[model samples]
Target: MSESLGDPASAEMNATAPETFRARFETSRGTFVVESNRAWSPNGVDRFYNLVRGGFFNDVRFFRVIAGFMAQFGINGDPVIQGSWRDANIPDDPVLMGNTRGRVSFATAGPNTRSTQLFINFGDNSRLDEMGFSPIGEVIEGMEVVDALYSGYGEGAPNGNGPSQGRIQAEGNAYLEADFPSLDYIERATLVGEN
Candidate 1:
C-alpha cells in the first residue's frame, strides 16, 4: 500500500476515473470482480479507483453484511489511516442506475457523506434510489463470494449483534478481532489491469 490512499483529502482522488474499469477483490471467502462505470457516478468512481489502486481496501473487514440486503465494508484497518478519511466526504451523484442485485454503491449517513464505506446489493434495493445512493458499479464475477461473506453479526450497534462503527474507528481491528472474530475480510483489492 502507498501513502497516497492514507490521505483521502489528497487532490489525487479528484481526478476523473476511466470510462470503465474492473477491480478484483481477493477476500477471506474467495474472489469477486466489480466493474465500475465512471458515467454512472464520476466522483464516486474516481474515489473508488484511487482507493483500490492505493491499496486502501487491503485487510478491511466486511463489517456489515445483511442477509437478503447488502454487504457493506471499507473502513481501513488502521485507525490512523481511517481517521485521515473521517472528513473527506464527497458530493452525492445522481442515481443513474437501479440498485439491483450486485450493484455497488457508497454507503452514506445522509447527503454527500460518501467517503470510504461501500455496499453491494444482494437483492433489488431500488428503493434506495430516492435516498441518493448512486450505483457506481456492479459485481461482474463471483457474486457468490460476496453472498458467502459472513453475516452472523447482523447490523452494527444499537441494532443487532454486530460491532460498533464507533469502536471500529477508535480501536481499529483490535476491537473487531476481539469481538467479531468471524468477520470476513478482504485479503487485497486492486485495479484489475494495473495489477
Candidate 2:
C-alpha cells in the first residue's frame, strides 16, 4: 500500500530510522525533549535530511525563540555542550523534500552549506523548500513546547521589532533574552527503527 499521512501503517513508514535518538535539552528555565526514529543519508543526496533524522547532534539548544512564528534550535556553540560534535559541512539536499509543518529541516545560508543548524516547522512553509530547505522529520510530541517560545525581535534582529521577527544566527550565536519561557530545549533525541 502507498504511504498516507493518516494511516498508522504510513506513519510507521515515515519513521524510517534504524535506531531512535532522544535529544534532552537543558535550559536555565526548564528541560524539554524531542524524540525521533528516522535516519538521513550521510553522503547521499538526502544527507541533510539524514543528519536531522540521525540524532547526530542531540542535546543542541533552541538558540532562537520567536513568539508566534517559530522557536528555532539545533546549534551547540559551547564546546562543553554534550553531543556537540565537530564535523565538516554536508552536501545540500534541496530537491527531495519540503518544509512542511512539524517537519525538521536544516538552516542554511546558501547551497551545500549546512553545518549543524536545524529547526522545527511550526506551520507550513512551502517557500523554504524551493530555497533549499530539507525536511527530515516531524515533531512526534511536544510541539506545544515548540510553540511556547517567547517571540520578539531578538537583539540585532534584521526584521526590526515585530512579532514574527526572530533570528537564530549560524556559528553558535544565541538570542539576547537571558530568562524567558515558551523557549524549548531538546532534552534528548535518539533514532529508533525504520519501517
Candidate 3:
C-alpha cells in the first residue's frame, strides 16, 4: 500500500513543483476527467497534482453535494490523513477564472485556507470568483456524472443534513457510509498519462 497523505513522513512532501496535468476520476456515479493548467492556479494545481498522484482521493466520499451549486470532496478515507491535511493549507491563487459550470476550485474557509477540499461547480457561480475561489481546472468529460451525484443530504455541518467535517476527519469513511449511505464516492483518481 502507498503512504497515506496523513502520514507525517509524506505530509512534508513539496506540492509546489510546477506541472500541467490531467486527472481521471472513477466514481460510483461514473468517470470524469479534469485537465489542469499550471498557470491558472499554480499552488492549487500543484497540490491537486500531488494528491492525485499520491492516491489520496481513492475511496473518498463526496461529502457536500448541493444541487444547482457544487459537489465537494477531498477528505481522505483514513482519519489520520484527513487530520494531517486539515491544516496543510496552500496559498490562495488569484481568481483568474470564473467559477463557471464544470470548473473545479479549492474549497476554503477563508483566504489562504485551501487544504485538500475541492468543489466542482454545477452552474455559473461567478459570485465565488470575487470571493477568491480560483478554479484549478474544469471537467473535460462525463460532467453528467458529476451532476448525478447524490445530493439528498445537502450542505454539511450545522446547516444541513450532511455529515460533519469534524466527524469525517475523526472517523473517516465509516461515518459517511453509516450516515450518508447514498453519497457517491471516488473509487479512484489517476493521472491521465500515468500507467
**Model 2 stretches with alpha carbons more than 4 Å out:** 1-59, 77-87, 153-183, 191-195
Candidate 2 residue 103 C-alpha distance from true site, Å: 0.5
Give the Å error, residue 195, model 1: 2.6
Task: Give me candidate 2's TM-score against the actual structure.
Answer: 0.57
Q: What are the lDDT figures for the candidates, one per model?
A: 0.92, 0.48, 0.89
Ranking under lDDT, best-scoring first? 1, 3, 2
Question: Model 2 Cα displacement at 139 (Å)?
Answer: 0.8
What are the per-residue Cα lDDT tens digits for candidate 2 across 1-195?
122211212333234333445444344335445454344322222333244345434444565554534456655433433123334356765346556666677677677766566677777778887787766555666566566654543422344442122233222324323433334455444333331
In candidate 3, position 134 carries an lDDT of 98
- Better candidate by lDDT, 1 or 2: 1
Candidate 2 lDDT at 60 equals 49
The model with the greater TM-score, 1 or 3, is: 1
The per-prediction CA RMSD against the true structure, in angstroms, equals: 0.9, 10.4, 1.7
TM-score of each: 0.97, 0.57, 0.94
By TM-score, who's the top model here? 1
